[model samples]
Structures are given as C-alpha cells and as structure tokens.
Target: MAADEGLTGSSRVTVFAMFGVAFGYATHHLDARRVGDVAVVGPLTPGVEWGLLWQMARNCGRATAGEAELARWVLTQATRAFVCGSGRIAQFPEQGWKLEPGGKRVRFDSTYANRDQLWTGNLTVEGLAPDQVAQRPTIYTV
Candidate 1:
C-alpha cells in the first residue's frame, strides 16, 4: 500500500518500517546488538538495506525522529566499514578493523591513512548525537 502512497524499488516495505516505527511512537536509545547475529526479516541485508528502509519510511509518512536519524547515519557508516570495503577491505585485503564488544564509535572508515577490514563482533549504537559525518565512501568491493 505504501508504494501506491509513493513507494517503489528495492525493499520498499523495509523503508516503510523506518518511518512507521520511528514516527509511530516514542523510541528510546535501544536496538544495540551484533551485526552478524542480526538478520533483517526480508531479503534485505543490513547496512545496504537501511537507506531503502528510510525511503520506505518516508513513503509511509514517517519522518526521521528520535534515534531514527541516528539509525540512518549508522547505516551509512556500516556501509563504509563493511559493504564499501573501507574499514576492513581497504588496501585490497591487507589491513583490517575491528569493533569490540560494547564498542561505540562515531566514525570508522577514515580514522586512518588506509582502509582496513572492518569487523564488529558485538556493539551497540548507544545513540548518536546531532552531528553529520562526512559521506562519499569509495566502493572497493561488491
């Protein structure tokens, strides 16, 4: 129904949830968990599917609220660290990065001179403050 309400493309339903859950009620600073252990219900993968989820939320008339905005930001960072190959896959399979348990990071991709394999065993967002980090991470892997 959201597509009729202006939703389309990959993971439209997931996008809708971003807005629906974020806007439907008051969300606290929660959802801290492991990346590998976390599995999205649909065909969508973590990190990559987040933007789509946000778009779906917009379609469903949900604005980025509470931790929603932070969630979006985290999604971007995750893409940089994992999907884009900036954190761990940087330098062509030589360097690597790891996020330890209970780790809270503001940024990951550009903390060093080279990109390394980014790994997060267990971590929580702990919530993001009102800040915008740099975007435009290079895609070194599929």
Candidate 2:
C-alpha cells in the first residue's frame, strides 16, 4: 500500500514507540534506498510493526502527525555512514574496510580484502544526545 502511495523502489523503515503516556503512538522513519523494505525496530528491544499491524490507525488518506516530529528529530540526531573499498588497490587483492561495532571507526581487513569474503555486522547509530544508541545492520552490494 505504501508503494501504491508513491513509496516505490525501496526504503528502510525504522519504527519506534514512545512510552510514559497512557497510550502512546508509534512512529516510522522511512529511509528511501535501492535496497528493500528493511524495517528495523531495535536489537534486543521490544517493537511492533506499525505499518502491518496498524495501517488503519495510520490514516493513509493524510499524513501522520508524528511525521514532522520524527523528521525534526532525525534531522537533529541522525547520522549516515558509508563503508566501501578504498579503490586504491592496483592489484587483485585490494584493501577492504571493516566497520567497527560502534560505527565510529573502521580498519582494513586483508582476509576480506579484494572482496574475497563478505563482512556482515551491526552498525551502532548514536543519537546526538549522550548515551543514546540505535543498532542497524550493515547492508552492501557488490
């Protein structure tokens, strides 16, 4: 349905819920990319499928009130990181980068260099505020 509503291609949906209120509403952050509809709530954290479970509540006819609020928050807190080969290798076994767990640092791994093996891991996205971190899986294409 979201695709019918102009969400073509692919998007990464990040869904989160706010507590404290009696009946708080959930929010969805859509990150448009060429990958797929990869929805992430949290790692080792409780979550819900806002789009699949509460489609009617979302009221597709109009925009959700949380959209603006989430956008503002994302703009202020979110950070994007890209990892790839250095492309400086003049030989068959080129150097590849390995991202650290926190997504703050990366190092060169010879074992997986030159695309010998694939490296899969989780990227920790820290918010602007201290002590806030969200874990997102690393996705790449050859």
- Best prediction by TM-score: 1
The candidate maximizing lDDT is 1
What overall lDDT goes with each candidate model?
0.24, 0.21
- Listed per candidate, the RMSD to the true structure in angstroms reads 17.7, 18.2
Give the lDDT of residue 98 in candidate 2. Answer: 19
Give me the runs in candidate 1 sitting further than 4 Å from their true place. Answer: 1-65, 89-142
The TM-scores, one per candidate, come to 0.21, 0.17
Per-residue lDDT value at 34 in model 2:
27
Tens-place lDDT per residue, model 2, 20-119, is 1011111122344322112221121123222222232233224654532332222211111011212111111112211223211112233121121121
**Candidate 2 local lDDT, residue 72:** 29
Looking at model 1, which ten-residue stretch has the lowest summed lDDT? Answer: 7-16
Encode model 1's per-residue lDDT on 1-142: one tens digit a residue: 0111111111101111222121100111113531122211111222232234334424443354533333344344434434444332112212121122321222233322121112212211212121211122343211
